[model samples]
Target: MKRTLLAASLALLTGSAFAGTTLDLGYKAHTSSTKDDNGGAYDQPFVKITHFNKADWGTLLAYLKLENPGEIADAQHGKDGKLTVKNLMIIDKQIGDSAYNWWLQNFLVSNRTVMEDNLYLGLTTNRKFDKLFINAGAGLNYSAAHFDPTGASFDGISGGAVVINAIYPMQAFNLKHRLSVNYEGQFARDDEHKSTLGYDSYGHQIITTLKTSLTDTVYTKLHLTHFDSWGSSPNDGIEYGVAIGFNF
Candidate 1:
C-alpha cells in the first residue's frame, strides 16, 4: 500500500511544471508530549523536511519527517530506538477562472510497523494581505484502520474539516525572516471512528514556524505548535522548539 501510494505521488509530481526546491537539515525539540510510534503520547526527537513546488496542474506541498532517529538512543528513543516516518502531501489546483481551488490532501504515518493513512478532498480560496498569503478550505476526511498502543484498532470514515494555512515574509535589521502557519481540524465526525486518531483530534493541530536567515544558506528557525484535542487521547498543550539549518 505504501509503495503504491508513493508511486502514484511520484507520477502526479512528474511533469513539465518543474519549479524551485528548498532543502534543510535540522533537529527539532518538542516542549510537550506528542503522538508517538506506539500510538501513545511522548516527547520524540525528529528531523523534518518541507518542500513546495509549482506544477502544471497547480501547486504541490510535501512534508517528510523522521521521528526518534535511532542514533539518539536516549529516553526519547528508549534502549532500542526505532525510526518512524510521517508524511503529508497537498495538491492545490485552481478552478478554471473560479475563486476556489480544489484541494487534495494525504497523510501517511508509519508506527509500530503499521502504516496509517488518511485523505481529504475539498475546496479552498487563496487571499493575499500585503506580505501574507492565506489559504482556507473545508473538506471531507476518510481514515484507514491502524492499531493503537493497546493493539486495538481504530478506523472508518471521519467527516468534514476546515483548514486555514498562511505564510508571511519580511526583512528585519540585516536578516530575512519567514513565518508560516499550518492548521487543519475536523468539525464533524463519524461515530465509528470518532476516536480513531492517537493524538490531536476532534479539535486541531496548528504549527507556526519562523525562520531567520543571515544569508541565503544559513538560518535559524523557531517553531511552535498548539494541539487542541477533544478525543480519546485528550491532548491539549503548546510546544516550542528551535532549529538551525541551511536553506538552499
Candidate 2:
C-alpha cells in the first residue's frame, strides 16, 4: 500500500512537471533545544518544485528535505547521530473568483527506522493591497506513525491537529520579502492503550525569506526560521540559511 501511494504521488508530480515547473535547491543548518536542555544541531539540504497549469486546473508542489547529510551531527540519538528525510506534497485550487482557495497537503518523514505520515486538508484566503499581499489558512491535520522494529506493542498510532498558517509579503529594497507564521495544536487518544499522545500539544513557527535577483534568471535567497513547541512534546529550534537559485 505504501509503495502504491508513493508511485501514484510520483506520477502526479511527473505529470505536473511536464507543464510549467520551477525548481529550487537549498541547504540549511539548524539546532534544536529540547525540554531537558539537551540540544543538537544538523545540516539539511532541500529541494522544492512547483508547477501550475495555464488553464487554472490548480497548482502542485513537491518538497524534499534531507537532514544531517554526511553524518555531520552535533548530537546523537542512541548509538547513531540524528538523520531524517522528509517529503511534502501540496495541491491548491482556487474557488472561482472569490478570495478563497482549497488546499490538500501530505507530509512523510522517515528516520531510516521509523516513518511518520501526515495529511492535511484546508481552506485559504488571500488579499492584496498595493504592493503587499496577505494569505491566511486553516486546516485539519491527521498523522500516523510506524515503527520498524518487530514485536513492538505500538503497531501504529494516529493523531490529529488543527493547523493554521499566515503569510505576509511586501517589497523591500527593490527585493521580494515575505514573513510567514504557522501554528498547530494536536491531540490523540488511543483506545487500545487507554492513553493519549501529544495531548494538549502545540507548536508555532515563524519564517522570514528575502529574495533578490542575481541575474535575469537567477536569484539569491536568505531565510531564517524559528520554531517552538510545548505541552506533551516540548521542543524549540532555529534555522538559518542562504541559497542561490535560478528560474527556467
Candidate 3:
C-alpha cells in the first residue's frame, strides 16, 4: 500500500499539466534532548526531497524525509527515536477570490517496523502585510498506528489542530535572509496505553534561512532550525538542526 501510494504521487509529480514545478534537495543534522534521560542528546541526520507544483486552480506539494540514513544505532533506537521514513502530501485550493483556501494533507511515517498514518482536512488563509507574510490554519486529523514487526493493531483516533506560520524577509550585512516562525497544537484523546503512547502534541519552531542565488535556475539555502515539542510523556524534546538546500 505504501509503495503504491508513493508511485502514484511520483506519477502525478512528473505529469506535464502543472504550470510550474520546483524541486529541492536538502540534508539536515539534528540533535534532540529529552527530559527523562537526564538530558541525553540524540543525533539524527535526514535527507529530504520536496516537490512543489502550481496547478491551474491551486498548489500541490510532496515531501519525503529519510531520517538517520546511516542507520546509526544508539540510545535513541526505539521509542525515543525518529522515524526512518516520512512522506507528506498536501493540496491547497483557492476559494474564489477570497482570502480563504481549502487544504487536504496526508502524512505517512514509518521505521521499517512500525508505521503511523495521519490525514488532515482543513481551511487556511494567507495574508501579506508589507514585508511580512502570515499563514494560519485549523484542521481535523485522523490518525492510525500499526506495528508491522509484531503485527499488532490499534484503533484509530480523531484529533484537531491549529497552525500558524509567519515569515519576514530582511536584508542585513549585504545578505538577504528570511526568518520564519511556526506553531502548531494538536489535541487528541489519550491512547488506550497512555503510559506508552501519546497522541496530543504541541510544537514550535523558528527558522533562519540565508538564500544565495548561484544561477538563474539554481540556488543555495543555509538554514538553522530550533524546535520544541511537549504534551506527551517521553515524547517531549527540544531539537536543533542545521541544513543546506539546493533548489532547481
Candidate 4:
C-alpha cells in the first residue's frame, strides 16, 4: 500500500512537470554523523530529490528521499530496525489571480516518525532575493493520522501550527550550493488523543541540508535534523549524516 501511494505521487509529479521540469537523480552514502541526543540503532540513509517551480497557477516544490536500498531490505518491518520514508510537497496556487496565495501542503514522515501524518492548508507566499528562491506557507494543520514506528499508531490532528519550508539554491557560490529548511510544529492536537500512547502535547522537527557540488556532476550533502517529540526521549535527538552523491 505504501509503495502504491509513493508510485502515484511520483506519477503526479511527472505529469505536472511535463512542460517545464528538471529532474536530478543521485546516490548518497552516509559517511559520518553525530548528535546531541540518543541516536537510533539503525540508520535510514536516503536518495534525496527536489523540484520547485512558479507558474500561472502559483508555486510548488516537491521532495522525496527514499531510504537506502540495503537498509530498507534489512529493516524487516521493525524487527531489525525501524524504517523511514521521507517525502513532502508544498504548493501555493494563486487565488483568483489575487496577490494572496492559498493552497494545501502535504503529508510527510515525521523526523521522529510520529505525530505528523498530516497536512497544512492555508496561505503561502513566494519570494526571491539575489540567487535564492523561497516559497513559504503557514496555516491550520490537519493531522490525518499518528504513526509511531516504535509501536503506537492512530488517527489524530494538530490544532493548527505554522509549517514553514523554503529552499535556497546558490548556483555561483564558488561551488554550486543547495540549501533548504523545513519545520513542522505540533502545538496542539485533539485532546482525546493527546498524551495517549506516551505521546506528548507539543513537538517539532527541523530538517536542514546543504549540498556542495564536488564536481560538475558530483556533490556532497550535509544532513542535519533536529527532532523533538515534546518529551519523548529516544526520539528527541540531533541526527546528522554526510553523503557523497552524483548527478544523473
Q: Best lDDT goes to which candidate? A: 1
**Tens digits of lDDT, candidate 4, 19-79:** 1222334333222332223333235555666665556676676877655534453332254
Q: Candidate 3: where are CA atoms >4 Å away?
A: 1-32, 35-41, 72-83, 147-152, 193-196, 200-234
| Sequence-dependent TM-score of model 3 | 0.70
Query: TM-score for model 4?
Result: 0.66
lDDT values, one for every candidate: 0.64, 0.53, 0.57, 0.56
Off by over 4 Å in 2: 1-20, 31-41, 44-55, 69-83, 147-200, 230-234
Which has the greatest TM-score?
Answer: 1
Clashes of 4: 0
Encode model 1's per-residue lDDT on 1-248: one tens digit a residue.
21111122233334234443344555554443454422233445677776666555677889888877764634444545556788989988978755468999998888563456778999988776666677899888877755545454556667777889877776788766777798978766665454445443377778898877656556677788776763212466665677765443
- Give one digit per residue, the lDDT tens place, for model 3 in 1-248: 21212222233333223422334455554433453532323556677777766555666778888876766534344545544888988787868866677978888877755566767789988677776767688898776666665566555555575667666666566644555566655665335422223333444344555554344344456666554433212344544455555543
How many times do residue backbones clash in model 1? Answer: 0
Error of 1 at 245 (Å): 3.2
Error (Å) of candidate 2 at residue 230 is: 8.9
lDDT of 4 at 235: 46
- Candidate 1 scores a C-alpha RMSD against the true structure in Å of 7.2
Superposed Cα deviation of residue 56, candidate 4 (Å): 2.0
Model 3 RMSD, rounded to 1 decimal: 7.6
* Per-residue error (Å), model 3, residue 161: 1.5
Worst ten in a row by lDDT for model 1 = 1-10
Off by over 4 Å in 4: 1-41, 72-79, 96-99, 110-116, 129-132, 146-153, 169-173, 230-235, 245-248
